[model samples]
Target: MKIGHYTYQPGARGGIASYVRRLGNAQADIGHDVEYLCRNGEGSDLPSVREVNGDVDLFETAQQRRLDVLHLHRRIRHLPEHRVPTVRTMHGNQGSCPSGSRFLKRSGRPCNRDYSVSGCLWGHLIDHCGSRRPGNVVNNFRRIETEHELAAKIPTATVSRFVKERMIRSGCMPDHLKVIHSPAPDLNRPPAPLQHKDPPRMLFAGRIEPKKGVEWLLRSLPKTDVPVFLDVAGTGDIAYMQKVKALVEDLGLTGRITFHGWVEEADVYRLIEQARAVVVPSLWHEPAGLVTLEAAAVGRPVIASQVGGISEYARDPFALQVSPGDVDELAECIDRLALDPERAASMGQQARAIARDRFSMDDFVSNIMDLYRSTVTTANGLMRR
Candidate 1:
C-alpha cells in the first residue's frame, strides 16, 4: 500500500520527528511504498519525498499522489473526507488544552477543566497556565477549537490513554480515538553492563521547558541523601533554562549539575548507558514519555513522574514512580536508586526485558498498517454507499 506521511523538517531531533522517520523507514523496508511530505526535504533518508511549499495546496498534492492512506503527525486544518483516508496522530495535548500542556502554573498541578473560553482565559490570566498576551491566548483558543472540530471527523490515534482521555473531554469523539504508544528504538546489541558513576549520575534528557519539571529535578538533587550528579542532555525555553541555572546555584547544586545542550540522538543513548538512573520529572501531562521508553530500552532504571503514560511503564522492578512536582518524593526515589547499586542494577535488567517484550518497531509498524488498511476500507465502503 502507498502511505503518505505529512510531518516536520527532515531529520528534526524531537520525539515526533524521530517517530515519523522510523515509522516511514520501517514501512518502506517492509515493501510498502512510503513517501514523506515534509516541509524541508534536504538530508532525508527516505526513498520518496516532496517538499510542501505554499505554491501548491497540500490536499491537491496528496490527491495527485493517489496515496492509499495519509498519516498526519502535525495539526493541519480542514482534513479531506473524499478520496484520501487521513489518519491523525495526536502526540500531545494541543487540541485539548489551550496551553498544549494540561498543567496549571500558579497551582502547579494538572488542570482537569474542559476547554471553555472563560475557564481557559481565567487559567491564562489568573491560574497562569499559558501566556497572558491577549493575542497569543486568542490564537491558542482558536487553534484548539479548530483542531477539536477536525478530530471529531478524522480517525485519530493518541500516543497514550492519558492523551485520549483529555481529547475526549475536549470534545473529540470516543469512537474516533485509539491509543497507540510510541515504539522504542532498536538497540541491536545486548544490554551493556550497568555503569555506576563515582557520584551516582542521573540523566535528564529532553527539552528543558517548565512543563518538563527540570527545576523540580534540580530541587530534588540537593535533597537526596547521596551526592547525585545530574547531566541535563537537551535544551528548551531560554528563560526556563536560566531559571533552572539560577535554582542550581541557589541550592548550591552548581557543582553537581552539568548542562549539555541538545546533543545528537546517539549521544543521548550513550549518556543513558553511562548514567545510574534516568529521570523524567515532567510537571505536565506527558502524552507518553518517549525518553522513559528510550531509557528503559538502554537498560537504565527510570525515575519518572507517575503522570500520564510514564506511570504505565514506571512500575515496580523496572522503575520507581514519583508524583509530579513532588520534590520530597522525587528526592526519596533518587536516593533509593542512587544509594543501592545492586537494586538499581536489578531494576535496569528488568527494564531492558520490558522494552524487549513491548515497544518493538516491527510491532508498531504492523499495528499502524492495520489502522491504515481499516481506515481505507471503511472509507471506500462509505463512498460506495
Candidate 2:
C-alpha cells in the first residue's frame, strides 16, 4: 500500500512527531511504500521528504501521489475527500473543550479554554483591555469550525480511551472513531544496569507547561525528606520555567532540583533507566502518558496522578497513583518510594513485567497494521458492491 502520512511539523521533537516517525518507519519496514508530508521538513531525520510551504495545496499533492491512505497527524481544515481513504489521529484535545484540558476547567484553574467560537469573540472584545492579535482570533475561529467539519467527515483515531471518550461526549461520531495507542521504538540496545546512587532521584520529562504539573512537583519537593533529586527535562513557556525556578528557590529546594532542559530521546531513555522512580504529576487529563509507558518499559516504577488514561497504568502494582494537584500527597508518595529501596526495586520488577506483557512495541505495531488492513479491505468491498 502506498501510505502518505501528514504532519504540521516534521522536525518537531513533540510526541506527535515521534509517533509519526516511528509509524512511518515501521510501515516501510513491513514492505509498504510510505511517504511523509510535512510543512518545511525541518528535521534532520527526515531526509527523503517533500517540503511544503503555506501556498502549497495538500490535497493536490496527496492526489498526485495516488496515496492509498493519507494519515493526518494534525487537525487540518478542508481535506479533499478523494477516492483514497484518509485517517486523522487525534493526538490531543484540539476540538472537544477548546481548552484541550477539561480537567483544568473542572479544577477551577487558569487554562486555555478561551479558544472556542464564543470565547474568540469575547477575547477580541477584551483586546481593548489587553493584547489579542487579529491573527490569533482568526486562527481560533478557523480551528473551531475545522474541528467540527473534520469530525464529521473523516474517520478518527485517538491514542487513548480518555481522548476517545472526550470526543464522543463532544459529539464526535462513535462509529467513525477508533482508539490506537502510539508505539515506542524497540530500543534494541541492552537495558542499562541499575546503578546504586545516593540521594534517590526522580525524573519528570515532557514539555514544562502548567498542564504537566511541573510547578506542583516543585512545590512538593521541599516537603519530602528522603533526600530526593529531581531531573526536569523538556522545554516550554520561558515564563513558566522562571516561575518554577522562583518556587524552587522560595521552597529552598535549589540544590535538590536539576533543570536539564530539552534532552534528546536517547538521553531521556537513559535517565528513566537510572532514576529511582519517574513522576508524572499532570494537572490535566493526559490522553495517554507516553512517558509512563517508557518508564515502565525501562523497569522503573512510575508515580503518576490518577486522572484520565493514566489511571489505567498507574493502578498497577509497580505504580504509585496520587490525586492531581495534591502536593502533600505527591511529596509523601515520593518519600515513601525513596525511603524503601526494597519496595521500589520490587515495583520496578513488576513494572518491567507489565511493560513486557501489555505495552510491547511489537504488539502495538501489529495491532495498528491489522486495523489498517481491515479498514482498507472493508472500504474496497463497499466500493465493489
Candidate 3:
C-alpha cells in the first residue's frame, strides 16, 4: 500500500509530528510506500516525499501523488471530494471549537458551546474565548465550516472518546466518529527504578500556553502542604513565558520551579522517569493528551486534569485525576502523591503495566493501515458499481 499523510510537518518534536514520523517509518518497514506531504520536507526517515510549494494547489498535487490512501492528519485544505478518498483524524479541537481547546480563552474554563454563528462569533467577541481579533476569528469560522462539511462526509476518527464526543457535539456524525488511540513512542527503554526523588519532583513536559493551565498549576504549587519541585520542559511565546515567569516570582516560587526550554524526546523520557509524578493540567478538551500516555509509557504516574481524554487515562492505579483549573484539588493531588513515595512507586508500576498492555506502536499502525485498506476497497467497490 502506498500510504501518504498530510500534517504540518513530517518529523518535528511535537506530538502529531512524532506520530507521523513513527507511523510512516513503521508502515515503510512493513514494505508499504509511505510519503509525508508537507510544506517543506524535513526528515530522511520517510522513504518518499512530496513538497507543496506556495503556489501549488493541494487537490492537484494529491492527484499527482496517485496515492492508494491519503490520510488527513490535520485540516489543510477543504478538498473533501478530491479524486482520492481522504480519511481525517481529528488530531486537534480547532474544527469544532474556535478556540481549539474547547475552553474559554479569558477564564481558562472548559466550554461546551455548540457551534453557532451568533454563539461562536459573540463568544469570541464577548465571551472569554481566545482570538478577539476579527481577522483571526473570521478565518477560524471559515475553517470550522470547512471541517464540518468535511466531517459530514469523510471517514473521520479521533484519538480518544472524549475528543470523539466533543467532535460529535460540534456536528461530526456519530456514525462517522471512530476512537483510536494514537501510537505511543516505543521508548523500549527500561522503566525507572522504584526509588525516585526523595522530595518528590513533578514534571510538566509540553507546550507552555494558556490552554495548558500552567498558571493554575503554579498557583496550586503555593497551596501544597509538602514541597514539590516542578520541572517544566517546554517553551512558548516570549510574552507568555515572561508572564509565567513573573507569576513564579510573585508567588515566591523561584526556588521550587525550574524551566528547561525545549529539550529532546530522549530528555523528555528521562525527565519522566526521574519524576515522581507527571502533571497535565490542560484547561481545554485536549484532543488527546499525548503527554499523559508518554508519562505512563515510562512507568510514571500522571496527575492530570479530569477534562478531555486525560480523564480517560488517569485512573486510580496509574494516575490521579483532578478537576481542571481547580487549585485546591490539584494542590491536594500533588501534595498527597509527594508525601507518599511508596504509593507513587506503586502507581508507577501500575502505570508501566498499563502501558505495556495497552500502547503498542505496531498495533496502532496496523489498525490504521487496515482502515486505509478498507477505505480504498469501499471506494473501489462504489466506483465499480
Q: Which predicted model would earn the best TM-score?
A: 1
Clashing pairs in 1: none
- lDDT of each residue in 1-385, candidate 2, tens digit only: 8888888777788588888888888788878888878786876476456765531366677778888777788766566644467777888866565435544433423233434456535534442211256776567556656776787776777888877776776656688678877654567665664445678899999998777888888888888877799998888888878887898899888898888889998899988987999999987777788888788778788999877777766657989999888999999999998888778888887877777777777787787666667667866787888
Which candidate wins on lDDT?
1
Which window of ten consecutive residues has the lowest lDDT sum in model 3? 52-61
Better of 2 and 3 by TM-score: 3
Candidate 3 residue-wise lDDT, 67-186, digit = tens: 888888767644635467668788888767866757787677877788777898877887668688878888888888777777777778788887777777877678767777875567
Residue by residue across 1-385, what tens digits does model 1's lDDT show?
Answer: 9889888764677788888988888888889888888778766666687888632466678889988888988878565555488898998888788878778888777777788888988989998998999899988898898788877787888888888887888777788788887887888887677866578899999998877888889888878899989999999777877888888899998788999999998889899988899999988778888888888888889999887777765656788888888899999999998888888898998888888778788788888987898898888999889
Error of 1 at 143 (Å): 2.1
> Model 3: which residue pairs collide?
none
Clashes found in each candidate (C-alpha, N, C closer than 3 A): 0, 0, 0
- By the lDDT metric, which is better: model 1 or model 2? 1
TM-score of each: 0.94, 0.88, 0.94
Question: Lowest-lDDT window of 10 residues in candidate 2?
Answer: 105-114
List all candidate RMSDs to the true structure. 1.9, 3.5, 2.0
What TM-score quantifies how close candidate 1 is to the native fold?
Answer: 0.94
| lDDT for model 1 | 0.84
